[model samples]
Target: MLLIHQLPPKPDYFRVKIWRRLQTIGAIAIKNSVYVLPFNDEAMEDFQWLRREITAGGGEATVCRASFVDGMSDRQMEAFRPLADHGAASERLPGTGKAPMNKRGRTWITRPDVHVDRIASAWLIRRFIDPKARFAFGEPKAGMVRFDRFDGDYTYEGDRCTFETLLKRFGLDKDSGLRAIGEMVHDLDCKDGKFERHETPGFERMIAGVVKRNPKDDARIARGAELLDTLYESFPAAQQRSRSH
Candidate 1:
């Protein structure tokens, strides 16, 4: 279920900063105060951390689950969160994809312009969730392509339209996470799913940890949304000068 978090009125920077961190824990923002995450243990803990962080930072918050009128949970909310971290960015690849793979999993990330191009990351994640999000091979041999998410043709186009085409092909059930989630995931899919990191960035793992600590809590879920947004926008570059601190 996608989680929604509502916080007391605070500076926009506070919200955005928190959002970026939450994404690292596997949460994605769907609304300004709402985030979407798959049903899993790790995601819940991540949400809880977000709630605590925001509260410690002087922001009041509430986390809740998002569901349609029919009450159907988001089907595409996935286990796609990557396993890397901020410190992990300095690690080097083994020099070849065919080299001995790790028992855990092969690493796949490079220096990302998260602070340089937020639009690109936003577009990438959104596309991954939407299924309709179209893809081109920044790096080939991805699972989606193996699953036939896109034809073997290149479509150098804007994210909005091309993503819609991809969604049409996947037959999107619903768009859960923050609107920006589509953008970021799609960006990763275009570039990293193969050559780079999976790009969920250890979010899924963190979330599972959360659930293990706490069984169920709506407040944590809402906080997860706030954190996811922070993670989503944190990339592509730091925010431009907004309200003075």
Candidate 2:
């Protein structure tokens, strides 16, 4: 699916809003004012909605199906693969409320080598989402809940890392400290510097040191959780409470 649009130049905020909507739907830009998403029912619906929004905002928009032949190859397309296949699986748990009680006590799986995002996500699951969340690093089983992996139940959404995704999905986004930590994790894990929080550099170095010192995933997650706990508490108590409400 392709969404091509031209917005009126006067209102700058409208342009940013449209861009963010595109990102939320996991659209990839191939050219200026042109974006691509995997041709699927969800993608088609998303593009249609964006087209309407653009047209209503005093913009011209078109949604169409396109075949990539000349400049883009299948391999390159794979690089920007859409989340359609995994979207249905992830929807089993909605973000409308708190983490579901039925989701507790399940083994969460991920890639063996734990890093900043995985460690933080694991900590989040244990600390807030599920106190008894058991983690395993290997091939996911039939009933295992996965995180940070491509087909996981919880993973990246648009530009968000797994930690940010989990925070948003589990109704934890209102907490200011968790939101700040999510920004730091996003900057470190995605390496995009979208949120260059002043604390991100130090957080990254500390996580790197944790990975270097801990050879096991369990140890890495344990050490990383301690760091994250301290960081979360470092925020002013009033600020955290005010936003959490």
Candidate 3:
């Protein structure tokens, strides 16, 4: 499915809003105004909704089925695979490719535009799982491990965010500070208000500032790691904090 759109130039916010909507639906951009997604029912519905929104915003929009024969390669086409199919079929492993569970010095790939859960998860990976982990942002590729995305080795399991998933998967859930931080990340990322920690608001603000100030993913991760480090130190174990309250 292709969504080609031209938004009115006056309301700059609308353009940003449409771009975010496209990102949320996992649309990949081949050009500035052309976005594509796998042609499935869900993808078609998402494109339709986006087309409506674009047309309503005093812009021209068209959603159509497209097949690339010349400009796009077979590997590039693989990027449009549905999110669920990104992983392997092996019961022992859940990532698109195989990597040792405790492997060090491997690149961790995730979706672009890191946010609260991605930042915290990256911090957890470096701080606990792999000290020398390298991070990359983009679609899943052969032999690259993924996280914080559909079918990733560590992704959302039920209501848990990637941060919480990583905590349990790596046997780090026993740490109190990590658990506390996970709760805050869960509430903020899931937007379910499950934890409602008093520090959540402040943490959210700080994360927003970090993302706003740091456009590069590596910079955001560096800045966010510092913030999470301070937060981890400030927090007692979950049980200790609960007992005090």
- Residues 6-114 of candidate 3: C-alpha lDDT, one tens digit per residue: 8899788777767755655567888999988766655665676567667766899899998886776545655764343211111111222223466687889987788
Better of 1 and 2 by TM-score: 2
lDDT per residue for candidate 2 within 1-245, as digits (tens), equals 88999999969977876776666566789888999877876567567656766776799989999897678754575577543322211111112334455788889998777888889999989988889989998789888898876555787565567888898878888878888999988766655468899988898889989999999999999999998888887888535565787
Select the stronger candidate by lDDT from 1 and 2: 2
Could you give candidate 1's per-residue lDDT for residues 148-187 as a string of tens digits?
Answer: 1122121112222233333333433144333334444343
The whole-model lDDT of each prediction reads: 0.39, 0.76, 0.74
lDDT of 3: 0.74
State every prediction's TM-score relative to the real structure. Answer: 0.30, 0.59, 0.59
Clash totals, every prediction: 69, 0, 0
Comparing 2 and 3 on TM-score, the stronger one? 2
For model 3, where is the 10-residue window of minimal lDDT? Answer: 85-94
Instruction: Give the winner by lDDT: 2 or 3.
Output: 2
Report residue 236 deviation for candidate 3 (angstroms): 3.0
Between 1 and 3, whose lDDT is larger?
3
